[model samples]
Target: MYEKYDVVIIGAGAAGMMSAIECGKRGRKTLLIDHAKKIGEKIRISGGGRCNFTNLNTSPIKYISKNPSFIISALNQYNQEDFIDLVKKYKIKYHEKKLGQLFCDNSAQEIIDMLLNECKLANVVLKIDTKVIEVSYKDKIFITRDNSKTYLSSSLIVATGGLSVPKIGASKFGYDLAKQFNLNVIDTVPALVPLTFNEKILNKCKLLAGVSANAIISLKKTLFEEGMLFTHRGLSGPSILQISSYWKEGESLNINLCPEKNIFNFLLDKRNTSPKQNINSIINSFLAKRLANIICEENQIAGNIGGLSNKNIKKLSDSINNWIVEPIGTEGYKTAEVTLGGVNTDELSSKTMMCKKHPGLFFIGEVVDITGHLGGYNFQWAWSSGFVAGQHA
Candidate 1:
């Protein structure tokens, strides 16, 4: 006998779980399914285990979308404060990390547990390790797959996420499903991943592994001030990850080696105070020894600060303030935290995440074109979008 559900959500991720909970609460017999052996594999590993659950300051501006206005409705409907209140109610302790990013004090499992517990309370059914072989719509019923068994639902939500972390079961299932219903999908790519360099630069910086410095990585008009790490292949860490979304191949990144202070004036003052200080020594005092050496070598600024003319000092300072590097490419989906593009927002209603072309079909989370900035913003999007759809589904 085929089981029937009021709502069937494919993908037991953050968004799917949230939707299941919401639909269940409304007494709409909901069943959440996942292909993975465990739920929240990505969430369990997010933020180094302490999941960056949500951002305290999340707005539509914090997101990147083809149709930017689409996110405004769902975000306003179920804001970050609502998620925070839920977390608080579960007695889950969390702390604000930085830039309004909040993480659990214990582990990301706390968040998964909280959501699972909420689903149980709401009488939601969760099934894991079930591969969805096919989806068909006949009349008004949705038929979905589970091994050889079939299930029916009045509403189907695809929260299959994106191709960001394939190790955790990321796939193009959502895109394929959207296409079956004639939904347009934006070209997808790795968003919050590390930028890689060509052989020349990689060889040059390979010896400086594990080196990190506060830098302003800018692409186009977007800029992020965060720690950038030097790896054997290229750059990683927060700044690189943040700027990766705005970057494309052949584009240059303007890096401020010292973003907080005016290096020219600082060097000038030091030159006046200590006339005998070497230029390399002065730079070394403010930067890592290897980095200072590299800068000096690259700029051809040799000898002591006392030996260099004021003109040369200005040039050196300007170079330091605006060091530019062109990235060869990104590490791609194998390492990306979130995907940049997915189901086009224009095909779905922002208010409820329901498809305008196909009623009762909703697309939420990273499967949609709305990709949040690198922070707790992505998870917040999952929650908000799911909440909105749960109300209508």
Candidate 2:
């Protein structure tokens, strides 16, 4: 026997649930399925459980994609306000964290429940712990597998997400489905992940573990100002994770330890005021004692500020402001919050997320080539893309 529906969505994640709800709202038959025993594993663990669901300041500039304009339509169609309204309607209390990031006041499960409730209202059917073994198209019908059962649908939406946080059930299932239908895929890489340093630099900064400072990291012409944390493995925190998206092997990372001040000029002026102060004392006056000592010892500049030559002092200050260091690599998908690249955006219609060659087949969420910056940008993509596809798919 063959079961059928107007729409069949795979993954049952943030994007899948949203799409399913939309389809059901349209009075179209829809079924949402996921291989995982639980839905929204990533959502449950996101933002340390609060779930960064959207960013108030989200824009096209904050996203990385082959064709940046591809996201404009969907983003403008269903933005942060639309999702915020849903949250409010469901009485899911939330607060805006730093940099326009919106997080739940309780647990991320609230967001998941919101989506599920929306699905329920629309009468969308959900099947969990269901695995899709194959996908094929014939006679304008899409077929999916779940071990022994096969289902057919007129519209098939792939919201399986990307290969990040695999422990939470992330996989390349969407990419594989896109390829099965002959769609092009971009090379995938880890994003919003920590950087690992070489032994040389790791040893030098070993004692600096657990230290966090406000810094600006520059990579490939992109700069981010946020907290940089020194970890036992390497560097992490907001600044490092933001820059890691643009980082490549062997490329140097230019760091400004004191982003708010001009270190060289500040030191030069301070020297004139306290000409009798020692170099260590002068550094400690402006920076933390431990950090100041580490900077001085790393550069091998010695003695009191008054005893140093003008050129040496200038160099020391310059090094503090423009420290250059290169990372060996990233922590990979195990720690990455999202994948940098996936199904090439060129292969699909930006407005509807439907493949140009395969109509009625849509690829949404992180499976697309577009990847957003750290914060709530990723979730916004899931919402916007899923919203658009749900309308037309």
Candidate 3:
């Protein structure tokens, strides 16, 4: 009635493949299956096809979870250095782009191919385009059935990922499965996504779309300093995306267009040297001409004021330096790079990534509550968590 295996893992993304390969290497008869036609589609399309595989400066501190310390043990067990050594062993040429984010030199396919080759060498069986229709537990075995065959295993690892980039087969199947097993699933939201604005800000963003500037974006006490981009929809680029993970609904973001300069003081100096000169001309020297105009216009300034009072200059300074913009919402999972939450860490083992109460069930990758900052942090989490689960599964 069923084909038996020591381990049956669902999903074939980065985490799934890594877990499968490790399980096989440990002499377990491993089977990895996925509903999608291609395995590692996320890897194939990441980093603009170059695949930002991992971050050299990866630490548990970079990850976000309800239990902030949940990532410690796994990250310690299989760190970024370990994964990098494996990449070195395969001779995959990679380069560090910025902030320790490592990417393939040619294509993301290299990373996928490497994982596939490792899976084959470990004798791990991968079945693509096979959707599991039913899953049930019997005695001490986990029985999972596809349209073609039923698989029985002692261990089941759920690496089904999360609802992000829906066009790539991302879904809530992972969360649903966790709930089916009585595991607590955390509320999820879009992370690392562009923030949309109201009609007035939307028009300004549309007018300044494609314009980018080095900026510091802050929400409450959290902040990110990176390149910010304006889009027709709203705000995007690294700064906005990084802050989006921490930004909540109905919260206004404090954005500093000029991080290094004290604009208020700069204007005071300029007032004496060229009091008659258009203030817009002075602000343009620091910010883009269009952005400067918007700030002046929003503050009810015409920029041609000769001998303007100190009060008027302070308003312009505040508008440029402490610009406040509240996002109506995000672009949603359609454009989100990752999901913010899933299978609560409290219900899972930090060291093994296995369900604490459900003995044989394991959760890893984006399916878990752990989410990392933008860059290669999420990929590192995938490798570390998957590696630890594979060792125990």
Candidate 4:
């Protein structure tokens, strides 16, 4: 004997919980399930405890996908404003950090508790630590559990997310499920992660570990101007993480350590005016001292600025302004903030997030090929896609 639900949702993360709440609100018997013992582990650790739940400047331009336009409908239907209204309704204290990124003033648990409370109000059933070993569909959806109990449903929603942060239960189950249903799956890669370099570059990073500087990190046309941090292994911080999404192996990145200053011109003017100033001391004014020392050492920039010829000045300037370094690889899924690709966008309807070939089956969130830039755009996608699918699921 099995207790059936009208809608069965897998992975009780952001999307799954939101979808379940909406489905329940619509008078559908919804069951949200997850294998993890603790719910919202990702949310718990997000923004260093205070979750960046949404972004005010969310637009199609901020997201990366094969078909970027696919997210328009869902995002329009349930925009960041709507989610922000909900947060306000819950009276959750929040503030905008920067670039429209909103984080709770207290803990991320406030957001998690809000979703759980909403689920409770909507009569959504939640099952954690319930592993579904298998899923199949033949007119009706069937979920086979590890406990030998099988649950059937009219509609199935897969919100299993992507293979990022494996510690939080991110898996390829969603992608495999899409393939099982004859839907196209995109090749996945780690995104919003730190870039690692060869020993030469790593050694410099190691020396300047804990040092930070405002930088403009660019890969071809794409560029992010933000804070960059030197790590023991390689480069990290917002600017590096943002660029890492677009960077591939063997490609060089043009990093401007001093984005505000025209280095070559600054040096020329400095040489003309302050003839007695040390070149290293001048660079240290704009950049971190440790990093300036490294740059000075690299360029063999010694002693006074007046002693240097134009050639020596240009060499030092180019090294600081156009610091080209190629990353050998990334930190990978273990440290990635999100996954780049998933089920092909063409495989599902953008309006409803439903599989084109399979009726009553849906995919949402990071599993659906719509990876947003760093900040809360990805979470907004989760809320939007899940809300949209919930309407029809």
For model 1, give the 10-residue run with minimal summed lDDT.
Answer: 200-209
Pairs clashing in candidate 3?
none
Clashing residue pairs in candidate 4 (N, C-alpha, C atoms within 3 angstroms): none
Residue-wise C-alpha lDDT for candidate 4, range 279-325, written one tens digit per residue: 88998898888888999998878898989888988888888788899
RMSD of each predicted structure: 1.3, 1.2, 1.2, 1.0
Comparing 3 with 4 on TM-score, the higher-scoring candidate is: 4
TM-score of 2: 0.97
Top TM-score: which candidate number?
4
- What do the candidate models score in CA lDDT, each in turn? 0.90, 0.89, 0.91, 0.91
Lowest lDDT block of 10, candidate 2: 301-310
| Model 2 Cα lDDT, one tens digit per residue, 81-150 | 9999999998999999999999999999999988988999999989998888898999999998888788
What digit string (tens of lDDT, one per residue) describes model 1 on residues 1-393?
Answer: 799999999999999999999999999999999999999998999999999999988998889988888899998899999999999999999998898999999999999999999999999988899999999999999999878779999999999999987988998999999999999999998999999987867875686778778999888889999898888888888999998888888899998878987988988887788878888988887778888888788789987677777888887887778877899999999999999889999999888899999999999999999888888999999999999989989
lDDT of 1 at 12: 90
Estimated TM-score for each candidate = 0.97, 0.97, 0.97, 0.98
